[model samples]
Target chain A: MKLYDYVRSSAAYRVRIALNLKGLVYESVPISLLEGTQLGEDYRALNPTGLVPSLAIDDQGSGEGILGQSLAIIEYLDECYPEPALMPATPLKRARTRALALQIACDIHPLNNLRVLKYLTGELELSEEQKTTWYHHWLKQGLSPLEQQLGGDDSRYCCGDTPTLADICLVPQLYNARRFKLDLTPYARLVAIDQACNQLTEFRQAHPDQQPSHPGENLTRR
Target chain B: MKLYDYVRSSAAYRVRIALNLKGLVYESVPISLLEGTQLGEDYRALNPTGLVPSLAIDDQGSGEGILGQSLAIIEYLDECYPEPALMPATPLKRARTRALALQIACDIHPLNNLRVLKYLTGELELSEEQKTTWYHHWLKQGLSPLEQQLGGDDSRYCCGDTPTLADICLVPQLYNARRFKLDLTPYARLVAIDQACNQLTEFRQAHPDQQPSHPGENLTRR
Candidate 1:
């Protein structure tokens, strides 16, 4: 298997976490969003969306296919290899878990992604402060509801004691939230959940800093 | 079942379509987003998120519980009553349908929703033209990916001949796209899929204007 990935993309970071959690080995083929590799004709042919973290599965039995959408990829992985299940057994529980994941993945993170922010300042002409406000608005809007859900019934992980789909989505959003310097004090439950999840080797290895092409170390300005 | 819904909300429209398709008789309780009815104390008690299309199922034998998140609500409805299944049988196919749905629901519609657009122009101070551009940008970004998937499959519906999760999601989004005056020519495959699905009676009854709160007789705007 080969993962076409970008380190800073939270969606890609999610697939990386899932692969690590399952102990699956894959070759990394870097597709730098910053360097415009995603816009190249070769990459575009592979993915019409020109999105990263496209998994090229080369298993002999199943034949070849390129899978997109991080949640869909994770769900497919869970179905194809169900040892350490990312989703729970019951239908209601699965819906809740998926809903929790979507709360962050859909509601919060998409508004603040690289392309979206670039569009806001570049094409839409939003000022820098306005752009920051746009980012924080979604962060606050979604985190409040998510924190309530997590604080209500959650213990260690989002659904239960073990990490599941909700936790898979939570870690990546928190990674993005911290980068934007958004205040997360109000979401104490989420903050606590994120802190615990980060300690595990699966998550630690999949951290943005641990990526083979991490640009944060040498080039990032303080 | 009682549905707290608004006539024009795309999220609410998705739930309405699912209910009609499943042949569930749900009582209508309109909470107008335009009039700020969702923020009222009565509605907020039912849904802390203060969003509409919150379904409360009241069965004589089974107890009532509030279901939120249009996709979650639809999935739960499918689970509770499984005769006319919305999602596909196989996990892979189901993931494909859902990935297509999320491409519209998560990536496109949220960005163009009333609240977000209001924030964009009001708080972020984007001009009217910029807001229009912002709306079209996401609509184009999301629909183009969907076009490729739908074009490849060429199913009568998004997955197969029968309407599934993808159609349920697509119809509502296409409704929003049309409302925004977006150029649908770029998404020819998606437009074809939506056109075929919208011709159905289930999709017809679920149209926004047919809802309890729509202002005019015809759902189509002048």
Candidate 2:
């Protein structure tokens, strides 16, 4: 199995952590979104979405079935490798976990993704400051409600003591938040939860600076 | 079963359709989002997120337990009542089905829902045209990809001949699109699929016009 990844992509980061948590060995074939590597003809055929974290499986014995979208790929991985279940067995519990995950994946991440930001600056003609403003606006909207939902009085993770699907989502979004220097202070509880997560090796390895392309240069303070 | 709903919310409409499809009898308690009913003291205790379509089940011998997001609530229903399976059995197929459902639920609907539009108009102070532009931008971005991802050539529905979780999501979104007067010509396949769903008694009965508090009698289209 080969993963088409962009080091800085948070969605890819989530999959990396998931893979590590499951102790899965997979080859990382970096697709540089910054250098237009994803838009190359070879990559486009592999993923029509032209997005990062495309998993190409030679399960067809010819590397024909390429899966795009991080969540889909992760679920695919969970199915194929079923030991450490990313999702719970009960449907209600699974739904809760997915909802929490979607809280980040759908509600928060998609809006602030590299493509959307590019769309803002390119098509909407938002100035640099305006783009940042747009990003932070969504960050606050999504996180504010989230804070209210899972504030200071919650469990060790989003669901409970065990790190479920929600934590997998939250850690990356927090990384993005710190990258943007959006005040993490507002979400006091979430920040605390994130602090606990950052201490672990799985999340540590998935940090953007740890990636191959992050270049031994100025790294965003986490 | 009791459903906390707004007659006009498309998310609520989806749950209602699912319930009706399952032939489950549920009592409707309207939370008028337009009139700030959801923001009141009573509703706040039920859903901290202040979102509608919270379901309460009394099988646990208490009315206080059940509450949360539409997808979560729908999954609980699917688990509790397993006769007509909304999701397929295989893990890969289920992930594909869910990815399709969430392409609408997480990506498209959340972006254009009442609150987001209001934020665009009221807070961002975008013009009506700009709001529509924001609305259609995401709709087109998400839907075009979804239309492509949908292997409609092989099946009448989004996934196959059976109306899986994807169809439950797609039918309501198309209803929203037609209401928004967005051009449907670009998505003949999606329209054809929705038409197939519309022919079903379950989907037809779940239409907004068929609901109890439908405003079609009092207020005309904007």
lDDT of 2 by residue, A16-125 (tens): 88787778777888887778788787887666556687776755333346776677677777877886777787665676676667778866787788877886677667
TM-score of chain A of each: 0.95, 0.90
Badly placed stretches (over 4 Å) of model 1 are A58-62, A213-222, B58-63, B213-222
Candidate 2 chain B superposition, TM-score: 0.93
Scored against the native two-chain complex, candidate 2 gets a DockQ of 0.44
Candidate 1, lDDT over the whole model: 0.81
TM-score of the second chain, each candidate in turn, equals 0.93, 0.93
Expressed as tens digits, the lDDT of each residue in A1-222 for candidate 1 is 888888878898899999988889988788888877887889878877777768887544656777777888898888878979888876667777877887777778777888888887888776889888888888888888788767876589998877887899899999888888999889899999998899899998888788756555323431
Candidate number with greatest lDDT: 1
- On DockQ, the candidate that comes out on top is 1
Q: What interface Cα RMSD is found for model 2?
A: 2.7
**Alpha carbon lDDT at B192, candidate 2:** 86
